[model samples]
Target: AEVAPGAVHVPDWLDLETRRRLVAACREWATPRAGFRAARLPNGGVMSVRTVCLGWHWYPYKYSKTIDDVDGAPVTPFPGWLAELGQRAVSDAYGAAVEYQPDIALINHYDSAAKMGLHQDKDEASLEPVVSLSLGDACVFRFGNTEHRGRPWTDVELRSGDLFVFGGPSRLAFHGVTKTLPDHGDPDLDLSGRLNITLRVSGF
Candidate 1:
């Protein structure tokens, strides 16, 4: 469904086996070397969700190769398979195939109490389409306009295996997850929270 201009949501995009494999890979990425950690904002506030990154370590408002806020370890490399998946997603959503070499993967874990504020992803230098994949539980995804983070927003229920892509005019639109529904995850996945994996081009 086209949520807005340049924004599309594809439901049940990932199959059962693909989701299982991605989940397993996520677990490995959440290891001690480059594990999930809460993001501390410049305002001395900590974000509700815990996140792990690949290819580039995302700070409050910048991208880097090392996690200075955490153990300062190098982030895991972005996998080629993920880039291919992202390319397929863009093609599926926009009905065209583009050269999408996503260099960053931000994996966020949202528990039942975790909620992300409405914000625009403008830290990256590239304006390539943002490819997001949902796993585990369902959530209310708030997609707002590019003007501001105020009203005139649409809330969509993003379930496990759903895919959302935003680019072009909507690339800088404000979007966030309001609330995650616990116990609504697929029992086959055996995950307690919602996992959101977003692929982006760092333009580094």
Candidate 2:
């Protein structure tokens, strides 16, 4: 479904086996040595969800090779397979051959009480479309317009294996996850929360 111009949501895009494999990879990525950790905002508040970066570590408004918020160790390198998956995602979302090479990925784990505010992803140098893949529990994804974070927004339920792509004119749109539906994940997945893997091009 085209939620907006240049924004498309493909439901059940990933199969069960693929979701399981990604979950296992996420577990490995969430370990120590510049792993999944809480992100502290400039306002001195910590984010509800824990995030792990690949390819390039991301601060509030910047991207770096090291996690300045953590031990300054270089974050995990974004795997080539993952980047290929992202390219495939873009092709599937647009129904055409797209020239996308996502070098960075933000892996976020959201618990029951986690909620993301409406914000624009404008910290990158590239205006490439953001590829978001959902796993585990379902969540309410608020897709807002580019003007602001006010009204005229659409709330879409994003479940496991769903793919959402927003780019082109909507590359800087304000969007977020309002809340997650706990215990709504596939029983076979055996996950406690939701996992969102967002792929982007750093252009660095």
Candidate 3:
């Protein structure tokens, strides 16, 4: 349970072996379920996209559709392990037995060419913190303030097996990835890109 004190970095939460396994699993998941579209900007321009979500696609940062997995329900609901992890993260951050059960784990994939602009994760019904895990290549994460998306920001290096948690006043903070640092993962992981799994309680 490592809290990102103003976007602090937690090295090796998953360790090398676990990180490798997670990367492989993510690649396997991204194969068939590709075609993650670029988000349309407000000016009618489309932002380049390499992200693929396991659940519904939030196009233009809005929930577009509900995906079914053979059955007619959502494909990737919250996993028990992930929810437990979220609880632990919250507890570790505040030193309290806070309950955080995240139902949506947005799996965002980023290639060398992919980068995210400043945005806030306010789509969830719960104001609880967001537990984000990084796998694959390392990237520079830019975290901004809650009111405005301008400067007075922190540049955090999100490497494989790193965890970032933001809540409270920082819950509505603006954040995005500036760039992915080149060749910053285990060679055996075959990480030509990066994957970010941010767990949240969408439905409250």
Candidate 4:
């Protein structure tokens, strides 16, 4: 479904097996070396959603090669296969051929109480499409306008295996997860929270 101009939401894009594999990969990436950690905002408040990054460490308003806020360790390398998956997602959604070589993956873990605020992903140098994959639980995704984070927004229920791609005019739109449903994940997954993997072109 086209949620907005240049923004597409493809439901159930990943099959059961694929979701399982991706979840396993997420577990590996969530290790202590480059694991999940709460992000502290510039206001001295911490974000509810815990995040971990690959290829580039994302601060509140910037991207870096190391996590200076944490232990200052280098982030895990972005996998080539994941980048390929992102390209395939863009092709499937937009029905066009383009070189979507994503260099960064921002993985966010949202528990039942975790929620993200409406914000624009403008930290990246590239205006390329942002490919997001959802897993484990369902959530209310709010896609707001580009002018501001106020009204005139649409709420969409994003379930496991769903893919959302935003670019072009919607690239700078304010979007966020309102709330996550508990115990709504596939029983086979055995995950207690929702996992969101967003692929981006850092252009660094």
Candidate 4: residue 181 lDDT (0-100): 92
Output candidate 2 Cα RMSD: 0.8
Can you tell me which runs of candidate 3 are displaced by over 4 Å? 1-8, 31-37, 64-74
What local lDDT does model 3 show for residue 184?
84
> Which lDDT values do the candidates have, in the order given?
0.93, 0.91, 0.69, 0.93
Runs of candidate 1 exceeding 4 Å displacement: none
Q: Write the per-residue lDDT of candidate 1 for residues 113-198, one digit (tens) a residue.
A: 99999999999999999999999999999999889889999999999999999999999999999999987897779688999999
What are the runs in model 2 whose C-alpha is more than 4 Å off?
A: none
Overall local distance difference test of candidate 4: 0.93
lDDT of 2 by residue, 26-64 (tens): 989877786778899999999998999999998898999
Candidate 2 is scored at a TM of: 0.98
- What lDDT score is found at residue 61 in candidate 4? 92
Q: What lDDT would candidate 3 get against the real structure?
A: 0.69
Q: Looking at model 2, report the run of 10 residues with the lowest lDDT sum.
A: 29-38
Error of 3 at 32 (Å): 1.8
Which residue pairs show collisions in model 4? Answer: none
After TM-score superposition, what is the CA distance of residue 82 in candidate 4 from its true location, in Å? 0.3
lDDT of 3 at 36: 41
Ranking 1 against 3 by TM-score, winner: 1
Q: List the residue pairs that clash in candidate 1.
A: none
TM-scores for all candidates: the values are 0.98, 0.98, 0.81, 0.98
